[model samples]
Target chain A: AQSVTQLDSQVPVFEEAPVELRCNYSSSVSVYLFWYVQYPNQGLQLLLKYLSGSTLVKGINGFEAEFNKSQTSFHLRKPSVHISDTAEYFCAVSVLLRRFGAGTRLTVKP
Target chain B: DVKVTQSSRYLVKRTGEKVFLECVQDMDHENMFWYRQDPGLGLRLIYFSYDVKMKEKGDIPEGYSVSREKKERFSLILESASTNQTSMYLCASSFFFGAIPGSGPEAFFGQGTRLTVV
Candidate 1:
């Protein structure tokens, strides 16, 4: 069985400031990594996914994540966050099945 | 664009009543999933179907059942609604026709149904 761990539940940052959401996973076999975003009252939208290849993968909305195999982490980062970026983010891991962490609430204050 | 539609956007049900949540996907995807979202907790899977008449229990499938009589429709049944079951239910579909060893399936989500159990 695989499990996803999201260390922080809430992250508060000012607009135009950089932000990072940490995620880690544990699994015996190879796994797939995904980041999903959820706006208020809305369903989950795929932010990005890392299946294989280059460690760094760029996703929509100028958001990107780096897959650090040695550290067992896939953290999401945005150099300059916007007010519109305020939302909830979830980190998930899928090996033969899927598992999700609690979630991180990003508050981009002006 | 992939389209997944739920039967209702909001619903209110009484405790001990049987509740049905319907979902349809137009992409003809082979994999359909039912999940519920709540504050703090992210999406937790209830059930999933890989093919017609085939179903598998997910992490939280204790009080729920599923039906997939057709390729496009998957239904989630709550045998007895409870206050704990009130949540935002989301349905997703993916083209995982042949679940290969390393195949990564990208899911498309529905708008979601906010179910309130009274």
Candidate 2:
């Protein structure tokens, strides 16, 4: 089983500023990490995933995340954020089909 | 493009009614999942089906049951709708070990159906 802990419950950032949402996971075996974003009253959309090879991975909407084995962290970062980027972000970790995470809410301010 | 579709975007059901939530996937994925999202609880897996006529109980499968009669359709049934069961229900589909490798955590999600039990 894998568990995820999002460091921040809510993060408010100014538009065009760099933002980072921290997430850490605990697993005994090899794990897969993912970041998903959800708009108001909408379902989750995949932002990025860290499977293997590169430690750094990029995804849609100018979002990126780094996978650190030792640190067990897969934090999402964006150099410049927009007002439209304000949404609820979730960091999930899974070994099989099951997942674990408390989730984080990112609010981009203008 | 992979698309997952849920039957109703919003549903209103009586407390004792037997509610059925339908889902279909166009990508022919073998794995289908049903989840319910609450304010602070996030997404809790209610049920999952790996293949036709195959179903598995997830973490919180107390009042929910699922059926997969065909390859494309999966349905979730609420035995008895309660206020606690009123939440945003999400359906997702993924290719399990298909041509796409390592797509385990990137399941495509459908526009969740918000259920309100009266």
Candidate 3:
């Protein structure tokens, strides 16, 4: 069985600032990583995915994540964030099924 | 564009009532899933169906059951709804491309149904 851990429950950042949401997984074998975002009163949307190959994966809205095999971490990062980036972010690991973390709520203040 | 649609956006039900949450996907996907989202729990999978008439229990499947008679529809049933089950229910669908070991399919999610049980 595999599990995902998201260290931060909430992150508050000012507008135009950089942000990083930490994600770690426990799996003995190889794993696929993903980042999903959910806006207020909306469903989850795919932020990005790391299937294979390059560790650095770029996603929609200027967001990206790095997959580190040695540390078993896939952290999402953004150079600059806006007020519209305020939402719930989830980190998931896919083996046979997808397992998600507790999620991190990012609040971008104006 | 892939579209996974839930029957209702919001629902209010009473405890011990039999509740059914309907999900439909238009892309003819081979995989469908049911999940419950809580404040601090993210999205927990309740049930998933890989093909027609084949269902699998997910991480949290204690009080839930699912039906997939048709290929495009997957229904989640709560035989006896409880207050603890009042949460956002989501439906998702994905294509099955015979994934290699450790690689899974990307999912498409619906808008979700907010179920409130009193």
DockQ per candidate: 0.53, 0.47, 0.61
Off by over 4 Å in 1: B97-104
Q: What is the DockQ score of candidate 1, to 2 decimals?
A: 0.53
TM values, all candidates:
0.96, 0.95, 0.97
Give the better candidate number (1 or 2) by lDDT: 1
Candidate 3 lDDT over A26-77, as tens digits, reads 9998888999999999899999999999999999999999999999999999
Poorest 10 consecutive residues by lDDT, candidate 3 chain B = B96-105
| Model 2 ranges off by over 4 Å | B98-105
The window of 10 residues in a row where model 3 chain A has the poorest summed lDDT is A91-100
DockQ for model 3? 0.61
Q: For residues A10-91, what per-residue lDDT tens digits would candidate 1 score against the true structure?
A: 9999999999999998887777899999998877899999888999989989999999987889999999999999999999
The candidate with the higher lDDT, 2 or 3, is: 3
Clash totals in order: 0, 0, 0
Q: Candidate 3 — which residues are off by over 4 angstroms?
A: B99-103
* Best prediction by lDDT: 3
Q: Is candidate 2 or candidate 3 better by TM-score?
A: 3
lDDT (Cα, tens digit) per residue for candidate 1, span B5-108 = 99999999999999999999998888889999988888898888888998888889999999999999999999999999999999988877235521245788
Residues A1-110 of candidate 2: C-alpha lDDT, one tens digit per residue = 67788898899999999999999988998877889999998888999988778999999999999999999999999999999998898888867765746678888888
Please state the CAPRI-style docking class of candidate 1: medium
